[model samples]
Target: MYTEQGDPCKVLKLINSDIQSPQEGEVLVSMMAAPINPADINMIQGVYPVRPPLPAVAGNEGVGKVIAIGSGVQRLKTGDWVVPGHSGWGTWRTRALASESELIRVPSDVSMATLATMAVTTCTAFRMLKDFASLKEGDVVMQNGGNSGVGKALIQLAKHSGLQTVNVVRDRPDLDQLVTDLKSLGATHVISDAFLRSRDMKEFMKGLPAPKLACNCVGGKATADLLKYLADQGTMVTYGGMSKQPLFIPAGPLIFKDVNLRGFWMTKWNSIRSQEERQAMWDELCDLTRKGVLEAPKHRLVPLQNFEEAISKSMDSFTNEKQILSMGD
Candidate 1:
């Protein structure tokens, strides 16, 4: 837990706290696993929009088992696997006393990593693809940060829906391997940011139809490249700003192309949607996972006691694998 907003590795401290029994409409959950996401890190540093009160537990997403349920609880029972229905539930601890309304039970057959990690990245990807545009089979989608957790999820989900994705990644020493990895995930095309800007990009665009949807996680020049290739009247949804830079949109596309710009935040989406709607989405995603269509991103499982090491690795540059805190039973 942390008492102040600062570096996550510095401010976070592990401590033993007494376990609480479930009250009315509450359930006692034993956390199984939780992934450390970029939003979790930003929330730790007080940079994210959502901030729990100071001296609060640190994690925002994870999977847990319903060990006990209060008398009024009806939706969940003991042995049910669950994830937070919304963000900021303080999932870092081994156990949580949560209201029944705060949890969404999921299938136990899926892998722990996939269950723990899907609430954010996979949900975000699903929503962006489904809600943003009227994309049909064979329609093209373009996205930057192609190797990020959400990026990978989007690629796979799109492929399953018969949509094509043009993924953009930064140049790296292992660029070839990364390209192969993305292609293996069903990415239609994977190119470097530098390539997106080079003269060859014009020739490449001639071979494929313009993308109807462009998912922007990195802003600045990379986003500009997305806009440049977006189809007329196409939609570009900005879900994250990893570059920490303002978008530089050209006027021509906004005017002549009639391109639309929008933003999405899963937390906000959850807050406004009904429980049934949310459950339907979760059920669909879980079914996809069960069919082996949605696999967990690359990750390393760190014991919960060694959370500091996991946090350190999550903040390291060029680290591609996700850091997941595993709570052994």
Candidate 2:
């Protein structure tokens, strides 16, 4: 990794990497694809968990092939495809070395991009639904930045679990188009911030349902607005700050409504689940995707060689879409 922000990230360029020939606990992998998520850049800027040592490789998650196996490794063969864990492996390169326990196996039918997208969003959404809110089917949820990767995943998961999502977004002139996009992705309801704040909006919401969960990725005023609509004893899970401000929750909601505000970060969340529980969740989620109940997120794949251009693209204006970094020729 480079020393400072905006610095180039060519920490190691071994002409030939030799992390292979794993010992009993380790496995060797030839990585295929990794998504460069906003969290990845946040790690690059020294604002994320799982920071490696200086001159260390940096990447959070990726899909790969088992090129070799360590001694006594019974779970994987030379041809298996796996997705590495949530911490650093520096997915920008060819080879990977990690313990067999670290890999999340995927079927041959799953695309590399799908594997890459599944880790953070799915893990966060799953925990947010099950752990934070103790969500029941027919309960409603609301979230800001609903067109985001995690937002889309949340939408599908909420629908599959017999829950509803009232997605919040900023007002745009082409907002109808955005609503249509989210609805097609299984959103139950979409409301602009302005529409949500008006007096008539509460009357409108009263006719359907009040959310038991408010998922906040955007902070500042957006988060405050969502809190207004939460039901009694509702929980709000804040995972991101696309708004760059600390979340502002009104005192009345917490006191009068008995709403609970919580936080979640995926890396630590995985530590709480048993291996079988993790695998079971993964299998069910993949089954849902395979059944067309969930679609893999939309992303622009950027080749690794164009790292600078990709960074620029990620920082560009007018993009509700996220990009994934790939090892394409």
Candidate 3:
């Protein structure tokens, strides 16, 4: 736990504390595994807007098993797998006491890594694709940060819905190999950031319909190039700004093409949507996972005791591997 926010690697430390059995309407969960999300790191550094009180837990999402249920708890039972539906339920630790309402039950058949990760990337991807665009089979959906966790989810989910994706990634040494990997995950087209603005893009897009939906995680020029491919009156939903650059919209698209700019925050969506609405989305995602359709991102599982290494690795900018805290066997 951290008393003050600064650098996550400097401030986060392990501490042992006793946890009592669940109270009324509560459940005791033995955390199985939790992913180290960039948002969790930002929260630890006091950068995220939704700051928990001082002396806060470091993790926001994970999968666990119901070990005990309170007297009034009727929804969960011992051994049922669960994931926190809300934020601020510190999941880095071995166990947590949560209100039954704050937990979402998922099937045990799904891998813990997959379920642990659904709260953020999967949920965000699902919402952006479903809510922001009225897309159907053969529709084109484009997104930047193509190799990111959310971007990976968008690719798979779009394919599952019979939609095609034009994914954009920053140019790198292994660009060709990365393109091959993304294609295996169902990306219809994958291009480097530089290619997004090139005349070659026009040739590549000739046969494809103008993308009716665009997802931007990297702001600045990458986002602007993404907008260039959007169909007339199309919508671009911005969920993250990894480039740390401001999004500048060119007036040509806004005035002549009627493009729409929007922002999405899963945290904000969770706060406002009804429980039923949230569950419905998860239910669909879980079904996809069970059917071997929605795959989890690549991950390195580290024991909780070695979390310092995990935290350090999470701060890397270029790594595609996700860090997961393995509570125990």
Candidate of highest TM-score: 1
lDDT of each: 0.93, 0.77, 0.90
The best-first sequence of candidates by lDDT reads: 1, 3, 2
Model 1 residue 183 lDDT?
Answer: 96
Return the candidate ranking by TM-score, descending.
Answer: 1, 3, 2
Compare the candidates by lDDT and give the number of the best one: 1
Which segments of model 2 are wrong by more than 4 Å? 1-20
Q: Show the lowest summed lDDT stretch of 10 residues, model 2.
A: 6-15
Who is ahead in TM-score, 2 or 3? 3
Error of 1 at 11 (Å): 0.5
After superposing candidate 3 on the true structure, give the runs of residues whose Cα lies further than 4 Å from its correct spot.
Answer: none
By TM-score, is 1 or 2 better? 1
- Candidate 1 lDDT, tens digit per residue, 77-124? 999999999887888889999999999989999989998998898999
Candidate 3 lDDT over 1-329, as tens digits, reads 88899988889889899999899999999999999998898899898987999898889888999999999888888999998887877889998899999988888988889998999988999999999989999999999999998999999999999999999998888899889989998999999978877888888988899999999998987777988889999999999988889997898889989999999999899989988888888889999999888999888999999999999998787787789999995
Candidates 1 and 2: which is better by lDDT?
Answer: 1
True-structure RMSD for candidate 3: 1.1
Please estimate how well model 1 matches the true structure, expressed as its whole-model Cα lDDT. 0.93
Angstrom error of the Cα, residue 236, model 3: value is: 0.2
TM-score: model 2 vs. ground truth: 0.91
Alpha carbon lDDT at 318, candidate 3: 70
Q: Would you list the clashing residue pairs of candidate 2?
A: none
